[model samples]
Target: MTGYVLRRVGVSLVVLLGLSFIVFLMLHTISDSPGRAVLGPKATEDAINAFNAANGYDRPVIVQYLAFLGNLLTGNLGRSYILNEDVSTLLWENAGRSAMLSLSALVLALCIAVPLGIAQAIRKNSFLDRAATSVSYLLYATPSFLIALLLIALLSQAIPLFPAEASQSSSPWAVFTDTRSMALPVLTLTITNLVVFSQYQRSSALEELGQDYIKVARAKGMPERMVITKHLLRNACIPLITLIGLQIPILLAGNLIVESVFNYPGLGLLFLNSLNREDYPVLLAYTLLGGVLTVAGNLVADILVARADRRIELTK
Candidate 1:
């Protein structure tokens, strides 16, 4: 397990390095002149050259990439030209907000999804199963932006249960204290994630129920509830775990739209601002951060799967 973890970490590092290089090359290529883009087109050639030299843009691409990699290893993510702030500081601040929102949404999704999924699986072709499946499919088919708009119209504009805009709360406690202000955005994310997760879980559970072990458990006169809970649910959870682990990055990325709609000050909002302002440092940092998170989530999922089922081999 240790060796497997080490190997995964090593691979993650290599992938991040490669991603950084690609982002650097793409940025330079897109901007035409990196220094001039940083300094503005109206700037004099000497000023541009000086800026390039100072930021090491005059260095070869490979050399610049190597320096960036070294700085990353030492936890120096560089400074943001647009924000005039350290990339790490911006990431840290925005990351917390994103984490809070996404984590809450994830928890809510699981809370709603698991029970519904289990019920649908157990009921099979009953009316409740059909209704749950239909609702899940409908939600899954709906675009997030549309759902956000619908929710805003219904919950915010008409019902007045939640505010259309998210409050700039510093912490989750603060946000929760003003739960009315935070409800819309969180609800948007929760509903969107719940649909996908519940469907996946339902499918997995149904498949697990058809397996030989489940039949044997039933034949052994195990109570239906016990068979479903102990035998089927545990095995069904493996696939759902993989999906949930992978969904972290998707949820984060999805927040780009969700945050914009609700005006939430999270990493997604920051990413949008960075793109609009062409803040290369923040953009690069966020990109790398997202990639790292995605890779790490998958690695954690692998470890969890191995732990849950000792027969699973990570070294493979």
Candidate 2:
């Protein structure tokens, strides 16, 4: 396991390096002048040139890339030209909020999905199973933003159960203290993710039920609950583990839309602001961070799947 983890980490680092370069090249290619983008069109040519020289934008692209890479190795993500703050600091502050929201939703979805799916699978071909399938399909077909808006209208505006939007406080941990503000955003994500998770869970559970072990356990006079809890559930969750690993990064991206609808102060809101301001450094760093998360999530998933199912080879 240790060797496998180390190998995966090494490969992930290489993939991240390539990803960074591609983002860097694309950012540079699209923008004619980073200096003008940062400094504005009103700045004099001399001022822009001076700004470029200071930032090493005047150097060859490869040279600048090497410098960027070196800085990245040492934990410097460069300064946000428009915000006049370190990109790393900005990301550190915002990413925590985004992570908190995404993780909360994921945990809630899993909790609801597991039991709901199991029940549906157990009652297959019944009215309950058909009803659940219909609801899951409806939820899955609905767009996230529309869901958020509806929740805000019903729960926030009409019912007055939760705030329509998150509090505008700048503190990253404010949501923890003010849990009410987190309700709408978390619910939006949960509703969006629930359909996918439940469907997968139902499919996996159904597959496990058809296996010979389930029949054997039942034939041995095991209780129905014991057969499911002791033998079937863990095996059924094996496929779900991989899906969860893939979902982590996707949730981050999906939260962008949800966050915007709720005005939640997370990476999504920050990313939108950066795009509006043409903040190239922040954009580059954020894009690179997404790559890192993708690689890390998949690696974690692979490790989890190995741990969950001993029949699978760890070396793979």
Candidate whose lDDT is highest: 2
**What's each prediction's TM-score?**
0.94, 0.94
lDDT of 1 by residue, 115-142 (tens): 8888888888999989988888898899
The prediction achieving the highest TM-score against the true structure is 2
Q: What is the lDDT of residue 283 in candidate 2?
A: 89
Error of 2 at 115 (Å): 0.9
- Quantify all predictions' global Cα lDDT against the true fold: 0.84, 0.88
Which residue segments of model 1 deviate by more than 4 Å?
Answer: none
Off by over 4 Å in 2: 170-173
- Per-residue CA lDDT of model 2 for 64-171, tens digit only, reads 999999999999999998889999999998888888788889999999998888888988988988998999999889998888999999999899999888867677
